[model samples]
Target: MIPLRAGTVTEVAVLGAHCDDIAIGMGATLLTLARARPGLRVRALVLSGAGTERAEEERRALDAFCPGAELDLTILDLPDGRAPAHWDRIKNALAAFRAGARPDLVFAPQRGDAHQDHRVLAELVPTEFRDHLVLGFEILKWEADTPAPTVFHPLTPELAAEKAQLLLKHYPSQAHRDWFDEQAFTGLTRMRGVQCHAAHAEAFVLDKAVIDFGGS
Candidate 1:
């Protein structure tokens, strides 16, 4: 893999279909970025779970994931698993978010995700953030729809472990789920790390990018 550096990313945007999707998909990466750039601007949007405990869980979870960063989160009350049906609202919300933040990098659900809510949001992201670098993050679930990721963010064992702990700690509502455990999170990170020749890592699908080979 040819290594490409995302130079001086001061702002980032993350989109999720549900409350814990961002943390599940790229918690370690957020941790890495926030530490590297203190007071980094992070804008997050979740389509479901507004006015509920799940939304509260997401607020705490993202704050923990993005330590020391300037984080702004929005949660909506759109029905879960039915994002495609609420296409207009989703599109409008995305447009409003795009107007508010000009992020250097955007973390969003991958297009190939099996979940309908996730897949719909992924499809809508590019329409709003047309000129930005968007990284499609994979969420481990019961479905066999993980994308073949083209980019990898290698993580230290300590960072990976910390991500898992944060996920477990902040989202008590998800603890009952069998897959929402440290072992599963660490296992996926370990496998991705093996693929990328690291001790631990997070993988992402790059839908598109404009590389500057000769720039500073």
Candidate 2:
């Protein structure tokens, strides 16, 4: 288990392209923070909020997963599958949103994701959160794009199960989608667990050297 120095996440900023992306990519991390530092405040920001059942579930699931935490989820109603084309609007809007506040940590999609929307959102995060420590998270989907993850988070099989359960239970609209299954998430953790020599694990690829070994 790579203990994260996410810096006592009293302030956190999470950005996503659509919905449920945050929950899927970093749900267990949220659970860990929510339990570890009960007072840590969290905020989720989405570029757009379109009227889809999938979108609605994300709102509800986030509340369920992190009850009483400050959550500012902004789902930009920009057309799905067109994030790259709207770069100026997204960059300016994210800049405006992040102007006064500097979060302790920023979690967003990996820039190398094969998904177009994810890639666009990933690019926008660095532009706005220029100084905050940024960590790229992966989502298992049709692409199954697994980049070389340098940071690994160890979770109990139970914690992994709970994370998966939250994903399955809270995001009902996405139930039809097979990957939303707890089993799939659990399976990936199992595989990652092997790499980290743990019972379960979630891996992340850092874009830069936030800190060297032992805060060197």
Candidate 3:
């Protein structure tokens, strides 16, 4: 596979509709980038679970996922599974976030997500961050919604293992879910790895990209 290199990534923006969505979808990618760019600035926004144990879990989980990077996270009080009703709140929050800083990359959900909340947030992300490289991460749920990703970030076994371990460690609230176990996470990573010819990987969908080959 041909490698597509991104320019120096000093800052990144990660958006999630729920507490563990970011970690489950693109935690390995975050880990890879954070390790590659020490002191990387990560601005993360989650639309729900604010003022609850889930929010706390998200804060601690992101800290661990990003490692030494500067992590700025906001967990909103938006109602769970009801984002479509609060369209203004979601849009305004995204616009405000876009106005604050310019990031090298943005990680968000794809519009094809099965969950209503995730699909709405995904639809709103591009409206604010136009002209930015947006990589849509996928969440493996019981719903038949995972799409074929156009991009892949292969992860080493150790790094993949660490991501699974971190998910299991920081989010005690999610431990009850049957699909939240180590085997499920690792299995998905392994399957993605097979697609990319790596030991493990996290895949993402690129809705749009502008490649420059000026010298050619």
- TM-scores, one per candidate: 0.97, 0.90, 0.98
lDDT of 3 by residue, 53-74 (tens): 9988898899989989999998
Where does model 1 exceed 4 Å of error?
none
Residue range 134-214, candidate 1, lDDT tens digits: 999999988989789999999999999999999999999988898889999999999999999999999999988887768
Rank ordering of all candidates by lDDT, starting from the highest: 1, 3, 2
In candidate 2, which residue pairs clash? 47-76, 48-75, 48-76, 49-75, 49-76
Clashing pairs in 1: none
Evaluation by TM-score, superior candidate among 2 and 3: 3
CA lDDT, candidate 1, residue 88: 97
Candidate 3 lDDT score at position 149: 90
RMSD to native for every prediction?
A: 1.3, 2.3, 1.0
lDDT for each candidate structure: 0.94, 0.80, 0.92
Estimate the overall C-alpha local distance difference test score of candidate 1.
Answer: 0.94
Which model is ahead, 2 or 3, in terms of lDDT? 3
For candidate 1, what's the RMSD?
Answer: 1.3
- What tens-digit string does per-residue lDDT give for candidate 2 at 123-166? 88888788778888888888968878878888898989988998
